[model samples]
Target: MTEPQTTHFDTVLVANRGEIACRIIRTLRERGIRSIAVYSDADRNARHVSLADAAVRLGGPAPADSYLNVRSVLDAAAKSGSQAIHPGYGFLSENQSFAQACADAGIVFIGPSVHALNMMGDKIRSKNHVAGYGVPTIPGINEPGLSNEQLIEAAGGVGYPMLIKPSAGGGGKGMHIVEREEDLAATLETARRVAQRAFGDDTLLIERLINTPRHIEVQVLADNHGAVIHLGERECSLQRRHQKVIEEAPSPLLDDATRARIGEAACAAARSVGYSGAGTVEFLVSDAAPGEFFFMEMNTRLQVEHPVTEMVTGIDLVDWQVRIAAGEALTVEQSGVHLTGHAVEARVYAENPERGFLPTTGTVLRLHEPSGAGIRVDSSLADGLEIASHYDPMLAKVIAWAPTRLEALTRLDRALGETVVLGVHTNTEYLRLLLQDEDVRAGHLDTGLIERRLPTLAFRGADDHLLAAAALFLHERALNASTTAEANAVWARPTGWRLGEARASRYCLGVSATDSVSVGVRGEPGGASVTVGDGSPVAAGLSAGHDGTMSVDYRGITRVYEVALHGAVLHIGADGFQMELRNRSRAEELAEHLLSRDRVPGAVSPDVRSPMPGTVIAVNAASGDAVEAGQTILVVEAMKMEHKLVAEAAGRVTVNVKTGDLVKLDQIVATITPVNTPDKGATE
Candidate 1:
């Protein structure tokens, strides 16, 4: 059939959702390509769903019923008039079956070939293959079984301390670092189990662990016409729990010789795989020896850290991915691509850093992203969006490009400090503190950088600055709301200096780390000296201005405050900071929050469904069936992952949903009637 009608394809279908979906849609629009978005029932009203030129509803909230299902995604592309499919980063991005399916359906898959995917997707196969291409690979075996005797003997021979990682994994799913000889077996088993459950495979391989490894990766692009080139390296050394937290371009650790050597080896690996489209060649550089870097693995798809490469090399990786997939040849040579400036990125997440990095879920009531000279926020979330427990807690990636490493670091720190996210707890403060640390600024980093420095980095508290901000914000708002108050009345105008007799010199204030305000109470204005203490005091001369504005010069910073006290909730220029002098409700809320601190991940009440997007896969009970107390009820899938929903107590399932069905958080998936209500002892 003349090689299936050659090229000529556009109108891309984005088979993913969340921030990445929205990101791809924006790029598609810039390229003048109609973007079709495929969303599950849960994402029907999501930001990505709204951003697309067209959208197809792909079943329920769960990933299996929607995103991960090969049929559903491809079907959506067919129905939505999309000529090509772009699997944006996650979900079916690396799934070879999905890529093959797209090609079989005559739709272009905007990524490398299926052959390259299978070769590089299976970490073991790719590692073995790359070694044949003269790429420097660390010593490791690819098979699962060596006699326990042989395993121990091999470990002793290969030397102590090894990395047990999954062959088909990225994002640190099944990776472990064993330093001591005694810790090897236990660590190996633990990594294997997580790998098995996560990827349906427990098979593992052992590789010698570098004492001080600096993560550096080279970006490569190749076409079927045989031209290949490498974009400069990226330094992704700052990590927490084996995951990259911050990444930078033109690695500080690499010299010209080092970059050229790794780039050449990476290009050779690409040629060996007959790779097409954009790919990354990752290497772990050792500080133990004289500039030795070893191949870690090849990423088959576009990496999350691609923005750093883009900032430094000034290349559009996504555009290249599309053009190369269209069978176009690479026009740029090695000399054509030039590294410009230094760039750094910080991965912003929605989790309590102190709490073992467990994912958090809640509504984002407010959002103020960092934006300045060179900072860019790549995010998918919006205000009022519920961050569910169903997906990864990462909210956004903040990238800053500057003329130098020091400058980039400074820009990143400023950007992080300017960020403001309220309602949901975040690691913004932690990130800011990390940037200020000496070790980070010095660039003395490793894979274990964040983990080692977390005692200082992951600090959890709203300090004095936040407190002052909250107070100032409240004080300023109060001044605006009241006609009697001045802008400079944060802690009530210093006794009496005005015209009237003794008046109450009390002011209510709201305070937080990123925001603050204060307002004055002028019941008897322009009179006597107002007393300032725990409650209302006496200020005589403080005059009540006719205009509703109050300014306060406290702590060397002059701030305007609005003053008003109406029983409880104080409204400060439409921003209500409820300051109740009476401890009726605030105390209760604090007590409740303190009590709930001891809860575990995925441990919400059965009746209180998920408040974010996800899909339902496993239903333990059918309609009208009785379940034991605290039994597993259903399993929900979101973001290509699964979470089990359990029963709070013994109950009868009244309105159960099926495995393939979709569910929105809080939309009743099933109704439970107390087991004691009707049914007697029913044995399973």
Candidate 2:
């Protein structure tokens, strides 16, 4: 069939936020197309908003009031004079109704047709449709409106270890694995609630669970013409709680024949639905059967991990999406498609890995993205930018490309090591640990790998050298901010002060509020002597490098680090983690310890504080309610994920915040007074 001629649009409005919107804007700018960005109150000064040619405010911070409000987005498009709208991966990306609305409003939706979306957006319907075309599909029940009793009955035929998934959503939300019949009812209810909240659809599908399968998805592209093409497969097996964290192109699991088979299946699936633009046909490849894979779902929009495929294929997927939306034909045929080199992408999120990967919110005190021949960063992070809990926690995606898989792994590891994000706790250090794992490096992967290896990936504390570096960096920053005369006097400090001498300052630095390290320093500028912990004074030289890194030489070892000083906090990018340090006095530290220790015995505060800023989804506890330790007191929804605050000790609960109330970090939503329980030390 002949391809259609290209249709053009001058301005495109991006209906999304953060890195993906920034990504689409970059492509739009490259094509000489003006981009319009829509922002919420939370994203008023976001990087994406600043990057676009013009911007419109959608509404308030919460997504429902802003991004997900179809009227708000369409109004912004009309006001901005945008000819088309590009819905980046999340939010309204796969919303069939939104696509239909855009089409009705005469604004081109940069995705598949509304009909195609309707078919693929519903997991149950898509599976049935694709199965008719001989596409391998997992055995499942797709009928909607089935009650709990009906679902339980259907589960018997599907067998144990089945999965109940929301028919209308992806990203593992509203999905649960039921191993036994006893847990079916509760899980089913929870799944439906999450599904209704996230995707606005309570209907679900039940499917037989494939044991420990590798998540492989084929990237497919189609034009308005009848041509469709597959850009090979991506291994997205490394996930936490079913959310993808690490992804790579040219999956290691598939042989050429298997790869070709799956690629063809993906193309067929796309063609069956008349899919256009960029989309991903996901499959769960059976671990026991190497060549066996089943259709999972189709994401009818550009994926977050699309860059890894771009790095391998040497094609700009976003550029193609825009061109295709503009009525351009498929320029490359299946025969012309080729994959080169290996590329891996790691999603860096603003979360505390040690705290059950709970999402965190804070201003970006310092930011440093790795730069090299093989490293590519798709991000909108900047110094002083707030990591809001109202959106996705992903700070950025770091992708590395190399000639070989091993080399790609090596490059990605190095890139991650060089990257730094401070102010908000992040998973950068955790990702580095995962990359270094033997199983991960060897390509022995599956969806459950992260959950299994999580225990061994515990946060490693900073060493003495790192602490010393932080202390020195803080000292230098202080010296730089002083008056010229004061700075000169700092440089003249005596270098030969004896240990324990009053002239030799003994400074206590806190890694956390509790763990404090004592450091003594003598001399200044080019050469100095630093004493860390209880060790003897060691001669060291501290000097500022040209590239914002601090050069430090202690004893026989030498190292350079990127350091940023924000008030009393020292954000140090050293080794492979972002280290945060605060200077405290011995008296202060002791006082805090004493206060904590003497806090009226047995009168422990049972307050369940919101760990991050978010809206209260549900308050499960009422005043004077008896609750056990580990019982959920309230649930807070943040960053599109639900976090339940549980009681730390058995206690009587008191609810403070109601549902829909906006709460900040450490804001107590509920208080639980321990019932005859002694105050145990805080849970580690």
Candidate 3:
């Protein structure tokens, strides 16, 4: 190991967005380097833009128009006089053309060399290349330029229960598992479509699906001086749909000898490609045989879970990336690299886990991130920030470090419990539930763990207490507004006072589109008796804090809740769970009841609304077309994921949205009039 020397770069542009961009900017500021931020129209007021020394607008909200536009990124770098461009993980980070363009323009790309990017960026080529270095790879067919027919022909040798993966992209995108030979062709077509759209390459690879597999990846750092070292391994076994949810360093499944062996193999793969800068080599290790590991792929950029590695190793990976790009040598030796303590990170995504993990969009009305000993938050969240559907659903990452793995998991769970995101629905509660799983706590992990436990995990819904608190908070707000408007008029104040027995002020609150609760409050908000639904009346009180948090005393239990009002809906967050309660008027409730009663018995609603706001990528059914129940109507794409809107009942369908049409959440995109039922005059 040699003494580290300072690297100089007056200005460097970060060619990415979100938490990764914010993370990189912080490192640049600490190093006294001017940071330039590039943003799309969707991220005009993003946190990273504000944190940087200067910013340049890229273009539209779409990735192709902004983040993925290599020409625009280069122009921004040149306009800002940036000597180097640090692509933070996604977009053009592992893009060989982008790296070559940077070199042609005399701007340093803060990532691996073009040759390394080309070799390792494609999973098929990398798998073949690594196997030449004596690295073990899964038994699969990775021949490049294989058509769907060719892949189907080769599926027999690969065997059933094989994985079809896109060679050009990482992060589990365009990856599918084929359980039967009959499903190979259609799955291959779908995988190729996704690959072409996501990575601009439709090249496919077939791999033998290792059952009970553990996703372990080793972080490696290399410099132009031919020095490469592994920073230990990260356990990313907890996943759903092949996407990582939680990650930890120094895998519990690996003994010291196995860790060393895997680390050496990772180094060998990097050396084979002449890799430089921060990168990750992913491996699929069998849970049954932990010592046997198979090469999955090599990500030619920093991974999203790098913080877990940094927390345990006490190394700044982004700092090293910049320094290595500046022609600095690796000062830390492999012998000196040590993993201390334990660290765990849970990604907080802007999604509704209960609703099949659909992407969610909202303005950040209230934000609260946890902070304590060994707790770290790498986030792109801010007060009033608008979380849109244009980018990835991940909003932030919450990481915790402790002396032991169990303690780290505990701290991470506690931190997630303390996390508050009011307006947007997030996976904070889901992350906590996953952290508390018995298998997770015991380190009995596998890539299939989250998917298996997902059905059993009980996600908290809007319970009675939460509903009571929300009703009381609304009552308090109404009372204050009335008092402020007409202080002298006692009748104007909603105090529930009457000539005889005090009348109860009734409120119809909609917890969901179909469910509404009737809450009656007698007396003032400070001291009131409330009854929700058919439950008994209970004593309740509400108090406001200067920090915008409200304390609700419901059923003799007082708890603090973060509250924010967006339009007609009230967003309340507590115990890492968030619920939106809409104050429904008497007329609205009556209309809904009437509509329900008028519907045909056992008939689903004719109007089909979009579950999420996104662009309609495909319309499977045409207007006036007869469709069966569960038939696909249209597909909506948001946050790079496609969700199919299907018919709820057999009926004559009328599609309202066309391909490329942007639809809002809950917007009626189609209608399915049940057969034999009288035509409802146009769907509301």
Estimated TM-score for each candidate: 0.75, 0.91, 0.96
Ranking according to TM-score, highest score first = 3, 2, 1
Q: Provide the lDDT at 306 for model 2.
A: 97
- As for TM-score, the candidate ahead, 1 or 2, is 2
lDDT of 3 by residue, 44-159 (tens): 99999999999999999999999999999999999999999999987888888999999999999999889998898888889999999999999999899988888888888988
304-409 per-residue lDDT for model 2 (tens digits): 9999999999899999999899988888998898999999999999887876788888788767889989899999898889878788899899999999998999
Best-fitting candidate, measured by lDDT?
A: 3
lDDT at position 25, candidate 1: 84
Higher-ranked by lDDT: 2 or 3: 3
CA RMSD of all predictions: 9.4, 4.3, 3.5
Give a tens-digit lDDT track for model 1, residues 276-348.
8888898988755527888888888888888999888888888777777777778899999999889999887
Number of clashing residue pairs in every model?
72, 1, 0
Whichever of 1 and 3 has more lDDT, that candidate is 3
